[model samples]
Target: MIAKKILNDTFLIRNAKVEDAIQMEYVQSRCYPTLHESEILDRNHFANHIKVFPEGQIVVEKDGIIVASASSFRCDFPEHDSTFLEETDNLWITNVQIPNGDWMYGIDMGVLPEYRGLGLSKEMYKARNEVCAALGLKGQIIAGMTIGYGKVKDQMTIEEYCKKVMNNEIIDPTITPQRSAGFRWIRPLYNYINDPESGFGSILMYKPVDENYYL
Candidate 1:
């Protein structure tokens, strides 16, 4: 796909390259400071993701520097819920990708802290949706990070926090924007990752490429 310009040509969103792994790592580090090291995708993992599913990975560049990225892979809807590690095959998804799966599982998507508020994440999500449509997949599914939960964990239960976020009673740094991008919350996932900021909880969400999507 050709690079699409946005923000008055300040940013270009396009498919990711193996060479972008190092830069992607930089973005990842800056985007998820509270996340554990093991949970973060390393350079090797990024390279393997592009090799295994280039179409499912994309990056946003600014004058040739990658500032954001999203990684995904095709898979059938899971019969049982699983933690992020088990679901992502411990972040080495080479064996987790299904060649003809019905859904696009969004593994990671983040923009550099400095690039936040520019709507780069939304553009990345749109690109992923286009890939889903092109591949005739059902839609996209993700274990969304509740980046704002940690700060308020002492005041409310995970369920209460998520419910408030859903009802617009509160704004989550991650979930709020994802909701705006059209992802519907499916359920809550506990111990989703080693994320203290999220109180180790996450929300299962989905965005259908087609409005009439059904199981």
Candidate 2:
């Protein structure tokens, strides 16, 4: 996709282009540490994922260089699950994660070091919502981060996990244009919260898009 500059802008979140690979790699490297490269992701993997699944990967550029990226894609798995990469359905999706259901999925929200706190990440969500609505999708979803049960347990008693998941350190799905667009919020309690395989601070939230929010 050709990059469209936004309003003589300070930032532009546009469709991903083949040419943006280098800058995209640069951002991914900076946002994550070396240790994260094993469990999380690295630059080459990121570029290849976008090339293979362009539906949801987008870049936020300053001038001609990409400084951030956001992923939002659709699938038929049903319910909100973030580790869709764990799916054994298709060979093509082996490396890349494929979220379940006919929904707008968020792989992640990344920004360059200097680009943090500029609301560029949020703008990237707005952009994702726009695409979801246009595509006639029912909802938007993301595997949100949770602060870790161990950390929370440190703050409170074991009995507090349930209440805390809802009242406190939980990932809320309806926190964007998805909320304003009337998408339903679905929070599923999976082993991710208490399992060693799961990363700390990870939960899935889905928001269904309305018929008229962006028409």
Candidate 3:
């Protein structure tokens, strides 16, 4: 399905197509360089995502250039896993996606450097939330990396850092904006990703679908 257009038609958000794999790869590389090479999705991975769950992937474009994207999939909460980290090994979309699952697992999102300030990330999430409501999914979940925490890790613990970001006392390049978009911190996830600032940990977050939320 096509997502609602934003920026007065200056930009558009739509479901990912197999043709977008190359641009998606470029954006993923530019956005998360710290991640190990094995964790980055390749062109075939993108095709598989579109093949298995088309509505779960959303992309933004402006002047025919892809600028940002959000990729996700449906999965049930793994009750046996202690931390969300256990459920994210290798960060492969195929390993976790379950077609009949109740929750929407947010895999990753990115916005190219030049397009950072236009609120594209927020718009893409709005589109994702709509998909959740339409699919009758419970809510969106993420293992959110605290990319900014690397700077202050020596001064605080990961839990403390998340609280500060949520309280608005600090701004995490990633977590803070996610909170603004409606996700709330549920717990700390150890070894969630390879990001150094977060000490390889991240915050497990959730945002229940608000049926009344509108663009």
- TM-score of each model, in listed order: 0.95, 0.68, 0.89
Candidate 3, run of 10 with poorest lDDT: 80-89
Q: Model 1, residue 137: what's the lDDT?
A: 88
Q: Give per-residue lDDT, candidate 1, residue 167.
A: 84
Lowest-sum lDDT 10-residue window in model 1? 1-10
Candidate 2, clashing residue pairs? 77-101, 78-101, 138-209, 139-208, 145-201, 146-201, 146-202, 183-208, 184-208
**Rank by lDDT, descending?**
1, 3, 2
Q: How many clashes show up per model? A: 0, 9, 1
* CA shift of 174, model 3, Å: 1.1
Top candidate by lDDT: 1
lDDT of 2 by residue, 1-215 (tens): 32455535777778876566677767766764422333444455556656666767789877667888865446653443444344212213434444444566565567887877666766776677667766666656665443344445556543354345555455333233333433333564344322332233354555555645331
Model 1: what TM-score? 0.95
lDDT of 3 by residue, 33-126 (tens): 7776766777777777888789998899988788998788789965543433346434456777788898888878899998898899889877
TM-score of 2: 0.68
Better candidate by lDDT, 1 or 3 = 1
Write model 1 residue lDDT over 135-167, tens digit each, in one string. 998899988988899889999988799889878
Q: How do these models rank on TM-score, best leading?
A: 1, 3, 2
